[model samples]
Target chain A: MYWEKDIETIPREKLEALQLARLKESVAKASSSVFYGDLFRKIGLDPNDITTLEDVRKIPFTTKDDLRDHWPYGFLAVPKDDLVRMHSSSGTTGRATVIFHTLNDINEWTNIVARSMYMTGMRRSDVFQNIMTYGLFTGGLGFHYGAEKVGALIIPAGSGNSKRQIQLMQDFGTTAIHIIPSYALHLSSVFEEMGVDPKSDTQLAIAFLGAEPHSEKTREKIEQFYGLKAYNSYGLSEMDGPGVAFECPYQNGMHVWEDNFILEVVDPDTLEPVADGDGGELVMTTLLREGMPILRYRTKDLTRIIPGPCECGRTHRRIERIKGRTDDMLILKGVNIFPIQIEKKLMDIPGVGTNFLIVLEREGFNDLMIVKVEVQKEFFSGDLKQLEGLRRRIVEDLKSDILITPKVELVEPGTLPKSEGKAVRVIDNREE
Target chain B: MIAYQLSIFAEDKPGRLAKVTGILKKGKINLRAITISTSDTFGVINVLVDDPEGARSILEEAGLTVSMKEVIAVVIEDRPGGLDRLVQLLLENGINVGNAYGFVLESRKKAVFVVDVGDQLEKTQRVLKEASLETLDAKALSAIEPFHYMNY
Candidate 1:
């Protein structure tokens, strides 16, 4: 019944041995890259030195800054001709982190993604509709290839156009969809606007939600709205997106593929591994990647390992859904949001003032981020509808840039609080 | 043009209109006619005043968004068909009235309609003149003493 039954159900002892073998190969492959080669030589390290899983700790943690330091080709383990594709972060904050894949790497990623979909109970008979953005972003193509691999009827419906998306679902009788949890929540309103209850109107049975951290309450809300079982999927571009881990039918926690990568939870400050079942930073290493192999890469995502074996019978360890980031990055509605990114968007608009605040609150089970900006005195002289048009334009621009629609509240100039030192741009009221 | 109207950007909140009228009162600007066009959150207040420029500058100085717009003052009989006749003529001529307000100048014989024809101010005046309708410009509008009823 499993996609790779033997590999998936391998005993703990056998799994560890497989991981160790693949780990050594990955280290050797990574050493061929300029950045890792220099680091390995400086430490006088050898791939053969890592005989057991514990020896992986000897490798220094690779941070986002290191990725930035060696942009474009510094992490290339293979020749340029061997590379088949690449995916990258939006780089709204700084330099975008990019990941390259060889043809084999793509096939492996596709297989893992397919396995993930299969674990969620998606079948070849199902029509899978993928709603993530394609090109440069991994979520789109990652799920696209995986669903295709499962022999499902694939509809590569990119993000937005809510009406058309609904039409396609109704016309094709789509049985499955892959989308961000927040967008799924947002689409419920569109369904309501069209007088269609997703629960009774379409043939949706399963939803794969990822690309952002969401609470269990949000998952339940999305499931209730869409009338489908919502599965949590997790991945990062560095390790290949959306298939690093997935929820099985049991839905207790996400099963991280042990055959592909070594997962670790470590204290962010100490750089020491935390005991299993304790929350800390997620660090990962690629075992099967060919184009580029990352060792001990700190994901900066905070999650804990669910200490027990999953009921799904897969030997893969399960990681709890991500809690928060170690950095100031806010994942609002499944899109990475930085206060500075909002600042940049506001500064680009002519009538917007310098002082702005991002207020995040929870409306029902979904998170709502409202960007309150001051309108210049001169701009306030327009007709009431003109001001409204300006507000809508700002909202549209910000949504296009960040992929999450934010409510733009235009306030009078000098109304928002000013600061002398570093500005406090984000006021999170979600906890309240 | 004999009549000028001040269009002030206003938010739909209690005391917002008071704030605008308060500023005009402080400036001693007499309000001849006023109409508020509102949506959900914000609105526009179109006001015919004795001194349009003075009202605009003072309202702007008080931090209210204010602009001066030209409008035509039409004098019609204060009877049942007076407004209908004027509106029908504008409709037939394809002239859109962007903003309009009216005030009765006498008990039954006279009323003044302040119409902001937007960019069609000249064409609207021409249409009114050809139709033998009496129209007033800024000078005649500012000189009107409406409260004191006189025989037409």
Candidate 2:
């Protein structure tokens, strides 16, 4: 019933033993790269010295800047001819972190993603429609290969074209779909516009929602709208994307595949491991990747390990849904807030549309946060008092939720910018 | 008395008004009367048009938030006291005009005052009738040719 059952349900001690051996092999592979090789030799560290998982801390943490400083091929442990494919970040901030995968790495990644899909109850008979972008973004190809490996008829529906996506769902008896959570909400409106009730009209039984951090409420909203169970899939391009962790049928927390990744939750400031079940920055060490194995790469994603064994009979430990990226945290008026918190609060309020923008600006020396929310079309009926009341209520609600009174601006529906890729929720124009 | 008016929510920025008018012009929908209500950062434009449903759909398709609202249109004298009298009559009763605009049909002789009383449509029409105001229905409102004199 399980994919790679022996490894997936291995005893705790056996799993640790497997992880340590793989971790040492991965460290050796990572040390072959110029970046890690130079750093390890300079720091007087040897890959052979890492006898225990705790010894992983002895190796310096690899930062995104280090990757950027090394640029194009500094992290490649194999020869250029051995590399099969590469995926990259958007690189809006600086140099993009491009991860290369060898044929073996690709095979391993595909297997993990296939295992993840199977865990979510997708079978070979299922026709999977992947609605995430396919280019340099790992979400598309990662899920693409996995669904193919699962022997499902894959529709490489690479995002955006809501009408075409709906048409595909109807035309191809699409049983499963992989989409971002926000887009799933947006697509529901399109389905409404097309006069098709997704619940009754299509054969969508399973939805794999990821590529962005979304709350349980968002997942519940998508489930209610689309009439399908949406399992959360988590990964970043630094590690092979979209299948690093996935929710099983239980749908509680995503089981981090311990056989492939050595996961750690660390205090972002001190770089010390946080106690189990406590929130901190998630650090991952690649155990099976050969092309570009990274040791203790800080994902910048903040989440906690779910302390108990999954009821799904999988022995791999689970991690809570990502709270927010450590970099995406906004500090205003001495209060630290994540955009997801604002999204959760705004989404709960009636008449607030699915899209919003949190704009941070500086007026003189003080920081100002202005939340521009889209008022639903039905609610934008020029009722001056009612509109004012909604604005006031939003301001009050946000103030109570985030502990900072923000200027709430209600715009017409669909006024905020909609991104086909990952939605840019925050725009900070404050001068540092 | 189901006169339709296209109420559009707009941001108060340069060229925004031009953008709305440009869309209507391109769509071949004629605007009969238009009024803008502004706040600090945004405004709402209520336009009386010959084809309100057509205009609303086109505007909405063009990414503008347009809502078709039913309003009351009344013919009144174009003299200075014409609007004052109508406002006085509505106020004498408890009816509040949520939005109002006027266009002169013939200077000093006749004009049309379009008023939006929100959900209190029946009460406002009753008050207007009691005051002996000549209100135009949707047919008459759409048939109005501004500044073209026609003997009654």
Candidate 3:
């Protein structure tokens, strides 16, 4: 019943052997790329350098900056004609990062996602409706081809038009869906607006949620709203899209297909490997990709390798959900917030006091930023409406600047705790 | 002249309101009327005290953010539409009431409505005086206890 079950549950040593062999091959392939060729030539290195998995750290990290600086086809290891398909980031953050795939790479990626879907109970009898955006986004076409490979009845219903989406579900007896978490919530609300109860009205039973990092609470909310089991799939455009890691039936942690990628959890600050189960940055090396054999790519996604065996018996090591991304700035839900961003925004407002405390809390699968702003004495009045208006203005101002809606609490001056050392600015309470 | 109330900025938490009252009690300040205006995170405790200047310094020295704010006190009818008449008059004059509270001085004839008229304090006083509405200054308010006439 398992897709490449032997490889999935292969003994640790055999998997390591396979990884080592493939890693060497991947390195040889990557050296053909302009970026890696230049890097290897300058360092006087060869594919034989990665004899052991530990030797991976010896290789320089391929960062997003390295990818962007090189631009369009710099990371492509094969000939330009070999690439049949590509997926890209929206470039909303900055310049877009594009991943090229050869036909064989497409087959390989399709096979893994097929395997991922199969492992989660998708079969030929199921009607799979892709409810994500198509074109450029890997999530859409990734699952489309994977579900096709599974021999499922496919409806390429690519995103939005919520009413038609629900109609397609009821009309076709759709049993499976690949959707984004936030959109899932939005569709669920539409279902309520139409007075259509998903639990009884639709034939849907399974759902796959991905694209953005969401909370367990958010998943549970969707599950309750739909009366269906929702799964979280993790991937990035840099890693050739959405089938990189997936939650098994147990729903404990995601089994990162160890056969296809080597996983490394390193402390973000020290850049040293953390002990197993310790929270750190997730660095990945693609072993099977041919067009782009990215080695020791610093994903910047913070998660830990789940310690101990999963009940599903897949030998591939599991990884916790992404905690957050670390850069010189903070990437909260893919949006970068700088240390001075809040203070800078506050400076523009007339009545904001000098002292402010930023508290980051996890609110139901979301990062909640509560800015406890010390109310300026001149602004403080016994008038409730005026104070509330100030709070709303502060919220709107910060939202425009940082793109995160923060709850601005009007606190009295001298109430916030004093620090003896460097000024304490932020308090992050998000779980690792 | 505009009367004053000791406005203490307070955080909304257990025992925070107690701390403000404790300082006022220890300083032996008698309150004429008290009203707490709150937002999500904080509240302002506004008390028309027998001694506003004394209470402000006491609270300030106790590490509290305290201010003696201007409030206009007017004696109105202690009846159902007593507040409505005064409010309608102020609304017609374009005087916004930022904060307000009241207490009775007589059974049905006289009750004092204390209001923080913000920037329009002087204008509100002139409007009320022209309307022949009697207002209690700091001296008149602190001098009388309404319950002193009732012994039950």
Candidate lDDT scores, in order, read: 0.85, 0.84, 0.83
Q: Which candidate is the best by TM-score?
A: 1
Candidate 3 lDDT by residue in tens digits, B1-152: 67888787777888888998898899998888998878888787888988888888888888777767788988888899998999999999999987788988777867889988788988998999899888877777678777552222
Candidate 3 docks at the CAPRI level of: acceptable
Deviation in Å, model 3, residue A254 alpha carbon: 4.3
TM-score of 2: 0.60
Alpha-carbon TM-score of each model against the true structure: 0.74, 0.60, 0.67
Which candidate achieves the best lDDT against the true structure?
A: 1
Tens digits of per-residue lDDT for model 1, A1-432: 599999999999999999999999999999999999999999999988998889999899998789979997999999999998988866433456788999999999999999999988888999999988877888999999999999999999988898999999999999999988767877888899999989899999999998877779878888888889999989988999889999999888899999999999999889788887999999999999999899999989999999877787899999998888887778765456667677877788887866888889878546888887777666755356667887888898888777678888776566578944677568888762
Worst 10 residues of 1 chain A by lDDT: A89-98
Residue A252, candidate 2: C-alpha displacement in angstroms = 0.9
DockQ of candidate 1, scored on C-alphas against the true complex (2 decimals): 0.23
Clashes of each: 6, 0, 1
Tell me the TM-score of candidate 1's A chain. Answer: 0.88
**Could you give candidate 3's per-residue lDDT for residues A1-432 as a string of tens digits?**
688889888999999999999998999999999999999999988888888977887788888889878888899899989889887755223355788999988998898899999988999999999998788778889999999999999999998799999999999999999987767877877898899999999988899988877889888988898988888888887787888999989988899998889899988899889998999999999998999888888988889998998888899999998877775345454344665667777867876777888888766445678999877776665566767788899999888766668988988877777634555478878643
